[model samples]
Target: MSLIPLARLLPRRRSLGRSAAALAIAAVFTALFTAPAQAADGRISGLGGKCVDVAGASNANGTPVQLYDCNGSNAQRWSLPGDGTVRALGKCLDIVDRGTADGSLVQLWDCAGTPNQQWVVSGANDIVNPQANKCLDVRDRSTANGTRLQIWTCSGQSNQKWSAPGSGGGDPQPGGFVVSESQFNQMFPGRNSFYTYSGLTAALSAYPGFANTGSDTVKKQEAAAFLANVSHETGGLVHVVEQNTANYPHYCDWSQPYGCPAGQAAYYGRGPIQLSWNFNYKAAGDALGIDLLGNPWQVEQNAAIAWKTGLWYWNTQNGPGTMTPHNAMVNQAGFGQTIRSINGSLECDGKNPAQVQSRVTKYQQFTQILGVAPGGNLYC
Candidate 1:
């Protein structure tokens, strides 16, 4: 890949000369690498760990648990019980019907080593069901906690949290977090939460002008970082549509000169980047030359639009010219001084600094997998 190549994937502006230093930083970020142990295990950690509840699951001696959340209870305190059972508070984490669908639910059952019943913990802290060689997963890490756990194709990421028994300082609840299925789609298949490998393959086949560019290697690191950040924002692409759209309710109802409509009016923020508000719609639309309000859902339904919105936020809102996205992360604000910025509140909340920083630490795990240096910038 050329250090400075053809037209950038997204538009760039000159007024943002302030971003030049940051871009320089991002460009040089390509030298970083992943942890050797984690690489060997195929696990990555950075997304807030998923909380599971062991409620109703059996844990007598060897029974496994159906993964759930910790409502500040002991049932959720799971550890690896003797044999294959996941011993928590006092229960084990068992597989349901021994079935492993890249995205099916995980249930607690008797202590049995049926193929689906066995599981693996990777260096990246990802829990994998030995039966399918896939990681445990959640639908989308939906804001609503206590979501069900399932088995899905694996992609080492922060959302998939695990802990080794011998490792000192391990969380009392081992293997509690699982990856979001949508995240898996974005990584191996979608080319890092932004472009789909399938889509790229089809585009290459259909468009003679489309070049593999072999740029995948160059962008691999950046793509990983971008996906991590997005995972943090969208909770694993559970709501792809809302994850990429703009916030609604243009103005605070009481503050608006004209009262805003009720109900549907508040459903503005949608998609991965959560595009919201008439102003944001106009801004994104004008930037991409699309009429967003006319079709609010376009941002999520169209991959091109989705990519554009995310990239636009990266350029316009986060860090323009900062190709690597490292500096832009700081914009996440108190979330962490390290996070350059965030496109939506769905994840960062733009308030909790500790949570934001922790997420950045998780994003670093993915970036490391792709050879992106911590605190370093990346470029063509």
Candidate 2:
């Protein structure tokens, strides 16, 4: 069971039994994750080597954390078990009493796993509070004992640097794309079970650049923007097809060279973004290699195909706007541009503020859950 010997046995695994090889791999993982994490039982020292200490050695819920001399006191003993919290005296290092602002003071509070309690030790040695997008800073840059700590704009100043417990381990972030499956459900709780998480993830392969072409914040912002617009399109993914049956037959335009072979009423709005027009079905079908024009019903039938049709329009078509929704997000055009790209002419420029607000509200809520700020220009 000793890792040292098991690790040595890994390189010679071709000669070992299958059970031995599995054990060696297990040993590797155990060593990687079970090692004593940094700051597991250490004092987090900042400017002037002072420990990040809890005031008065209190275990109460609202105790203020302060800069104090490194006495190895119980108050200075801290543990960061790599779940985004700096723990001491059985409470979490928290942003207390005020909103997540630049000057919010730090405290010890109940470990609720909220964004206010999340901290990440970056490569620059600064402890960042993600909700406010600020760093754990020394108030007034003071090294004096009892100087309360606060979250401030990170300038990479010496006072902002700290030797904390872990660097790469923190609260769970977006693993693949910015929208995790849990977050997707929260964003669309009324979504049809057909719009499975597996379907969305599988569709990501169709558009290689979507939600994957920007910084972490930008990635999250783009995801929020996309999901918000689609939420409007599908009524929170609750509808697999357009409701009004009267407009169903009108989506087929006879002017196209290849007319609606699936009949006039076949190409109704369907899927996440709803491929409605016959020409649109043809285009999406060609791009996705799925004969959607000939068989428009496929969008509502296959979950992954449904998501792919949605991604097709989002990444390629501009609808009534100048840019695709994908380009709007990755190119720094803001969420407003995405709205324009999705349905701007009808909803943009004060024509339908209520509808625009609906999308913006969802985008804001999704971004909040993703632990990122929603960027500006949210309205079309």
Candidate 3:
């Protein structure tokens, strides 16, 4: 029951015979998955890598992965000998059977886990086959392109050192595990690329108290949910388009000196949440150390700054001792604020205010799903 068309949105399924073969392979994978290994995160050393279901990272079958200190974590659990060839979560990773050259896409498939899905881990952090002689390599070292896995020399670079890093509780670091620019767009059709820079990831890693809520389970769920909602609102990670800006410019005056700049301001919306208008742009710049008025495009250029603006808005609207602005549809309520911000901004015009019932409806919807008040922790 997806919004996009099935034929366009999903990959096709395999035939019956292929399905049986895949299951047989699954039996073998399951046996391996349960066996004790030198590096026990349920991972086998010197052969296959682990699988984590994070976005813009691992693909279905032929997805390239790396090795790390194994802990039998779900992110690391892999099933190689299964009905489908390369799989995780009971789905397969597919390599274009007759793919050409080094950058061909490695996609997911239904496992009949065949030779294509079967990879031999050679040396440290290298997926290779003594038979094939080629090792797993990412094409052009371009994290921007989707998962185009191919056979290259066994150099064992970071690009080749992939792991199925699982998502568990607490807030994921600002720039945690992300899909490469290429893979992000491929996985999500009609979407801009989602790339997480190393700096933000490192920063988030350091600020566990603020980034993660201290619970791995809740953190993972919240991270996934947050990414999904924000991606929908921001038009992927690029903020390339502003679908909700017709009414919700959040400006005091469109014609005022401090309104939107003639060429910019409301022209294209700035920052991650795309703060628009002269007032908000100036405010965001002041708060986040960027002069949005002087140079509006910086919002897209510096991802960390873009995120800072979104966080600033969120904190200002909900942080302690702060008053919620009339322009901001969502504020001071936990998840409710996120929902209201998303829902209300979708319909608000700078001239007119956000509809209360619309925001309330979204809040109710989120509450029902999350089982708590929206923005609950932030408000109190």
Candidate 4:
């Protein structure tokens, strides 16, 4: 996720080139390589310690597949039937639209035993789609959550390497109050399986401090508060990208050298936290080793990447706010400070009490549901 300009509501031009240098490089590395032990049931781990996950964990045809955290879920399980096809959820992992070009999307389709659906593990760890003679690549060599899987020429990059089942190191145990699939669904019933448990787990694994900081009670409160804010931002995860198309063109900042590779109108607010702006996308992408500046739509297209962008903001950025949201929660500065960290200038100090209260109301409800008390300072 990229940064949201605090000046987004104001007339002034806001720069999204905030320094992400302070963010831990180790966290980004861990996110890309953390994985569980190979299970008796075939499960492959790839870049960012993520399992190749079926979108929404659905067995339905045309379901998309992306990299997510290894959660020992059936959705992460796969099987090579030795017929040259990778099988999951009773379907074949296929190249979408029968596209042979670089960066074509991958999806689950009915097992027609076609050549396009067949994959081979080359000696260099490339998951080669024999039809196009291209390797299954983590789009843009990204370790960022929700980065789509595409087929590119074999590059021998870490993003293209795959550790087959029963190989590699042991799985890292998930610590703290991990959010369950049922609870996530309960919070956003309309979301169904779109916001997947494995995706959230993967993001959390990458940035453990987001929910694992401080005491268990504090951890739960932080998790609840973060989700509450995210829910409010996304309207319960119903919308993937910002609804207004008019504001899309305003995100590009031509002053930067790499200036909006995707498009002038790209980099609109997207994903759970609504990451927006060109510079923010570039910084976040650089830190996570993903090329979001070149492909900003990956946020809305991939759920894991979407959640990761949100968490990236919550944990690393202070923006126009005084403190990072992670600090506010861990230090017991109260939820009001968090609101300030996120959009204080616009919503805090009686600027927009209604919006502040809306966030607070969600936090309170989430705390109640998580069985933790919402600490004081609910107002900005």
Maximum-lDDT candidate: 2
TM-score of each: 0.36, 0.55, 0.36, 0.59
* Model 4 stretches astray by more than 4 angstroms: 1-173
Compared to the true structure, candidate 4 yields what TM-score? 0.59
Where's the lowest-lDDT run of ten residues in candidate 3? 1-10
Off by over 4 Å in 3: 1-190, 194-210, 236-239, 243-267, 318-334, 341-380
Candidate 2 local Cα displacement, residue 338, angstroms: 0.7
Model with the higher lDDT, candidate 1 or 3: 1
In model 2, the runs with Cα more than 4 Å from the true position are 1-175
- Residues forming the 10-long window of minimal summed lDDT in candidate 2: 1-10
* Ranking according to lDDT, highest score first: 2, 4, 1, 3
Total backbone clashes of candidate 2, pairs 3 or more residues apart or in separate chains: 2
TM-score of model number 1: 0.36
lDDT of each: 0.42, 0.74, 0.40, 0.70
lDDT of 1 by residue, 221-277 (tens): 334555565555555444453322233333223333323333335435544455555
lDDT of 2: 0.74
Off by over 4 Å in 1: 1-221, 241-267, 318-338, 343-351, 376-380
